[model samples]
Target: MNTPTFRNWQSVQSEVLRRIHAREWPPGELIPNEADLAIEFGCARSTVNRALRSLAESGLLDRRRKAGTRVAAQPVAKATIDIAVIRHEVEEHGAKYGYQLITRRIAVPPVSVSGTMKTRAQDKLLHVRALHLADDAAYAVEDRWINTAIVPDAAAEPFDVLSANEWLIEHAPYTHGDISFSAVQADQGDAEVLGVAPLSALFAIDRVTWDNAAAVTKVRLLFLPGYKLRTQL
Candidate 1:
């Protein structure tokens, strides 16, 4: 059989998604290895790797180092937490969005934060705290630290009109990152900012984004009580 020429990784990804959706590759079925797919698609192994990686990240495939790749029997509903912008999130709910810049300063981050970002303890980072509102009500509070060395423009941007969260989405495009979700009781500071009672349970999301291998920023977002995060598989 003649191999089909794929223009790019996206083409390969689309074809893979199409097959999975059409059940040509059924759930729990082992898919061809990257070498085989590359040859079939007339593309390089790296191209196939990128396509598969994207699908795995989206919760469509399960990839293991030694076990190879397989379609997920029960695909997880992955949230778009990696690239979600606060402003867009609020506006998407049909609510009038508002932003407040609470604080901005250059300071040494905590030891834990420094360790997570892999920055030296002596390095000064740009710290920014802000609140996002929906229809004039408290929505979420953002505590963020930016690496000035990696994002010099962050220092000059006042973060008054636009939030650092939205700004970074526009300016700093990351290649890879990590995100975690948890529930926490609102502390004094979180309560005051989110207009919730102290010790009230709230949803928290911690994210760290990187440009290639260099850390760009780390942020913790605490949402008001009763906030719901939903995604479809």
Candidate 2:
């Protein structure tokens, strides 16, 4: 018999982060409702909710009633660390910046996602993936999800020409959100995207944004190995 995939808050967080870094859900973009995420993750809605809540607490996501969730244009900096913009980070390192779009789609989110977004599971959401490069070398991968109900214009935006990251930062409006950081082993998909060996260590940043109580978007950014972040103690 085949074993069922074990779903948990950590897995959910990781998946969500993947999408964010891919720009499937761009900064300031609305994300799928929680119920959709829960269904997609094959986990309890409560579990998805818990994961989102943790991201929010970590300054990675913005959540609100009626408005739903969204990605933050400027992810809040952790008190212990200063948040750096991806493009700026690359330029500061004296590397030429590059970006590539990989995929875009609209699909029904898992129940867990819907539960977190406080929407029905049957709702469809916009998904996007992309890559960030520095001096022609893979710098990071982005995966994201967007809520059409809140940002209908997102459906027409051309992600192939301009990154969702730049688009949302210019178009979507938001008031508050959160950010977080961590380390994770590259999985098969991440390995392929980043051109690294599977199980390679990588840095991760998860963020969520909001326009008042309404959520704007959620995303995760995965950096290539050796990337360093500094903060004051």
Best by lDDT: 1
Clashes of each: 0, 67
Q: How accurate is candidate 1 locally (lDDT)?
A: 0.92
Tens-place lDDT digits, model 2, residues 16-69:
777777888888889988898777667898988888888778777888888988
Question: What lDDT is reached at residue 138 by model 1?
Answer: 90
Model 1 pairs whose backbones collide: none
lDDT of each: 0.92, 0.79
TM-score of candidate 2 relative to the true fold: 0.62
